[model samples]
Structure formats: C-alpha cells, structure tokens
Target: MAPTESNKRLALAIIDFLGSSLKDGTLTADDAESIEIAQSCIADTFKVDPTDEAAVKEAVGGQSLASIYSVYEKLRSKSTPQAGSASTEQSQTDKPKTGAPTAESDKFKSEGNALMSRKDYNGAIAQYTKALEIAPGNPIYLSNRAAAFSASSQHEKAAEDAELAVSVDSKYSKAWSRLGLARFDMGDYHAAKEAYEKGIEAEGNGGSDAMKRGLETSSRKIEEASRGTEPPSEELDSAPGASRGGGGMPDLSALAGMLGGGGGGGGMPDLGSMMSNPMFANMAQNLMGNPDMLNNLMGNPRLRQMAENFGQGGGMPDMSSLMSDPNIADMARNMMGGGAGGAGGAGQGGQGGQGQ
Candidate 1:
C-alpha cells in the first residue's frame, strides 16, 4: 500500500481503539507512548522529521486519548514520502499505524493568523472558531479568537473569549492583554487596568509593556472624566496661571495687570484722567455707537463684563498726550498727505518751522 493509504488505515485503527479505551478508562501512558512512536515512525518513513518546536507544544487538545490520536494523524499526514517507488513501498510497510483528529488545529491557527495579518478579522475569527472546535479548551486558540473579535470591534465577544482563555491558562499574557483592551472599550477602565496589570505580572516586563502603558492611560482618562474635565491630562492641575472654580475665569486684577501696569508712576492713568482723554472718548463713542455690533461682539459673558469695564471709564488709559505728541502729530500729518509740510499747508507753515 502507498504511504498515504497506509497512514490513513493505521490512523483509522488507532482512532477505533482509542475510542473504545476512552469508555473503559483504559488509556495508559504506554498507549500514549505507542502513539508517539508510531507518529515518529510515520515521519521517518516519509523522510520527514518531526522536529518543529511548535509541533511539540501542548498536544492539539488536552491529554485525552482521542486527542492524542488526532495529533498522530496530523503528524502522519504532514510527513510526505520522499523515496522512489520501491523504497516508498518499503517505507510504508515499515511505518507504524495510528489514528488522528478529524481536523488539524494547528493548520487552523496558521490560517487564522494569516487572515488577521490581512485585516480580514471576520475570516480570521472563523478560522480560530474551527481551531477551537477541533481542540476545545485550547488557551492559545481562545486568545487568538479573542484578538479577532477585538479587531472586528465585537468588544463584548472579545472579552468573553479572552476571559475563557485566561481561565484555561492563568499565565497566558496575551489573553490577559486582549481582555484588558476589550474591557477598556466597554468603559470598564478599572477592570481593564487590573487585567493589564495581571498580564504584566505573568509575562514579566517583556511582552506586557504595551499593556502596562495602556493601563496607565486608561486610569488617567477615568480620573479626568470623573472630574468633569475635557482635553484630559495628568499635569493639567499644575498648569501655570490656572485658577480655581474649576478653571473658570481669571481674576479682574490679574487681567488688569496683564493689560498694563497699575497704581500711579508710569502705571496706567486713573479712571477720571482716562475718561477726560479725547481719543479714549472717541473710541468709546465709536464702539457703543452700533447696538448690533455691541450685541454680536459682547455675546460671551466674560467679554460683556470686559465691555462694561471699558464703558465705566475705569479700564482705558490716558491717550490724549499720546495723540497730541509732536512726533505722533507729524506722523498723522504725513499719513494723511505725503508729508508733514503738505498737511500743515500754508497757514500752519510757521508751526512746522517751529518743530524744525
């Protein structure tokens, strides 16, 4: 018989025997060793080696006899014959027979990873689902399916799968990270933080660093939201010039000092002096002259208060001296015409001469 047909026949016989052993609870370590040896024999007969470290990982499923048979079948199918016709026939005869799973869970895992890489999350989920069906209670498969659910934005489903994976194997760091992300999406920041911390604890500081950072960020956001602050930040409270009253408005004295110096001697003029300035009076009149403009410009409460201050003649500085200064007068003349001399025409020629 050909190697493929021999492998298939052996696999059937092993599966049959394993099934019977399950009901009788007669599957022993010797039986498991026998299956492993048969798998190795099939691999060698086909000139293939079962040296893949991943292949040696936890058997496709838990330590059930049927699952072991499934693993043996998978190994035999993967071991392709490489010899000539006569040698192939001899190899097949020398190979041991065994049973295997109806499906290859590892293949499903690989296909799911490939689909995930392509961002076909739903397709990846299907592959992972198939893998879980073949090897139920597989922590790795559950974690992988959880990742697919997360990518598809099915956060609730992702959380459930991640929780199952962690329950299956508490040390599964990837599953813990996935659980954190799902919980974070569902607005369970505290739970997410705990999950991420658990992941970091299991994997040390290596593979769980990103999850740790995520926990820190989620904690900060939750704190900020609880405090009713937008544009969240950890250092917001320490910002310079920030006021109390939940960051309402700056104090009036602070605003005044910022606009100009205060109280005498090179400081801004007092309210009476400012109101007496003709230029200040002109600007004030111009602004209040238009009711529509005033309403539109002072719609904000803070701005309206500032406008009221300006109206009270307490806010403005003395501008009369500035407007009347000789340099300013000359500059104004030059601007109105081409030169001070032109603006000061013939009647004021002597006045320009006095400055010269």
Candidate 2:
C-alpha cells in the first residue's frame, strides 16, 4: 500500500520531536547526526518534507508534536491510576485553593523552564498553560509564557501575556522588558520606548543592562522614523544635556529667527518668545561667556554689515544679510543639529536647547 498523508504526518512529527530533543541536549552530537540520517531516510520512505511548515501544520491540526504529546500525557496521567497518583492527589488536596504557586503549579513551571531551555517553545507554552491553570494571574507564570510565546513568533500573544503580567505586578521588571520587546517586534517603537522607560523606572537603580539596551534601541528607532536620520549617540543617554553644560554654542538660526532673521518676512520675529526660549538663552549666555565665539560672529562680513547698520541707528537691520553669511550659516547648521538631537533630553528646567 502507498504511504498515506497520515503516515507522512507521523514521520514529520517524529522528525520534529527528534529535532526538539537535539536542541534540548537530550541527544548527543553523534546521536543527532545519526538521527539526521534516520530523518532523511524517513522523509524518503514516507515521501514527506518536514520543512514544509504548511503541510506539517495541516497534518498536525496546527499544534506542534510536543503540544500534542503534552495533551496525551495529561490525559494518560488522569486515566491510568499509577502508583504515585494517590500521593499526587493527596499533595494537591493539601495545597491552598487560592493565590499563586501551588506545588502542582511549581512543578509545571519547572517543566516549562526545562522545555524553554531546550528551545521547545510550544512544549514550554503548554507547561506554562498548566501552571497558569493553578495560578491564573501569577506574574511569573504569565511572564515566562510570554517569553515562550515570543520565542515561538507569537508576538501578539506575547504582548498580551506581558501586559497581564505587568498589570498583576507593576514592579515586575522582566514583564516590562518582555512587553517592550514584544512592542518593538510589532513595530510600535513609541510603545516599546515607553515600556522600557517604565521598566527602568520600576527598576529604580538605573535599570538592568538589558532594559537599558532596549530603551536605547527603541529611542534610536523612534529618532530614525521621525527624523529620517541617525540619532546622536549622546541622545540615547537618559539625560542628554546634563553633562554638556549651557557652555555649548547657541542655535544661531533661532537667534536670527528671534530677530526677524528668515527670508522675505519683514516684521520682527517674536523676541518675547525668543527671550523665553531655552536655546536662545543658552546662546546669549555662551556668547557672553565666550568672547571668541562672539568675535567670530561679529567678524563675519554679513553680520558686520548688520551690526554696522544697527549701530548707525538703522533699527532692526536686515537679518537676511547676517543669516546669509557662510560662517554664520555653518554655525547655525551645526547648532541646529545639536538642538534637534537633544530636544527630547530637555530637562524640567529646560537645560537642553529646543530644535529651531
């Protein structure tokens, strides 16, 4: 008789089981190579391709072989009255009915952890499900399952589990990290960044290295998506402007904008707002403290012309001339880049200059 689809599916499942075992270190390297040879032979005999995920899914009804085996184990454990079943039943009766981490749940969680270590994501998920049955709202169980779900490429489920874990225990840093990773995988960079930020806040002591790295990556993604350019390395730091004091040069374009500096528009720019702006205030402070920068600005021909005209009582001399100066324009461009890069790093006291 010709090999049926059922026969091919069985072979595929066995192949998957062997691969999972190999990943979990249940099989030695030589055993794995032998198993690989056996798998090829099985594939040839059954005319089945284990790599055909669609066929495998269809054959197994969308569940991994490990998941199906887990179900079988549960059913078998219940049906077959083994010698240890009486003791197991007694232990279950002795545990509390409410709250998390019953003996049974812990056992399941340990199994899940083992499966996770072996890279058996579906198997781990099944074990975690069993754990969650005993302790539905347990953050650790939810978080572990979320990790398994993420490993298995079920990002939406991972996010859901991570969110539930955090909701149950807001202080859980791992849950928050998992949530950030899930959100990032979904391309929600803003949400990922917020999650990482919350995770850091929950951690209190500057957060874990993993959480910090996640935050930095998400921040970079946000900057790239919004600004269409690479973000400055310092901007990834928690406080962008804390180290770079107000000594940095001011945004020249902003100063010009405040003094009616752009093209065509003749009326004076909002000097009141300009005075209130953190960038302009920093610029004025820097110029006052750094005579060299001020001299450099004044030495530019266009700025010299404007200053000369203004000195002669020509009120509000055309700032276009000042802005058009190559030296001034170059300074403005550099300052503008810095301002934009650190805009999000502006502290409560407005230490960082706003992008013009």
Tens digits of per-residue lDDT for model 1, 133-172: 6566577888999999998999999998887677556788
How do the predictions measure up, each by TM-score?
Answer: 0.39, 0.39
Best by TM-score: 2
Instruction: Report each candidate's C-alpha RMSD, comma-separated, in the order given.
Output: 20.9, 19.2
Evaluate model 2: give its lDDT.
0.70
Runs in model 1 with CA error above 4 Å? 1-103, 205-207, 229-356
Which prediction has the highest lDDT against the true structure?
Answer: 2
Report the C-alpha displacement of residue 91, candidate 2, in angstroms: 15
| Prediction 1 global C-alpha lDDT | 0.59
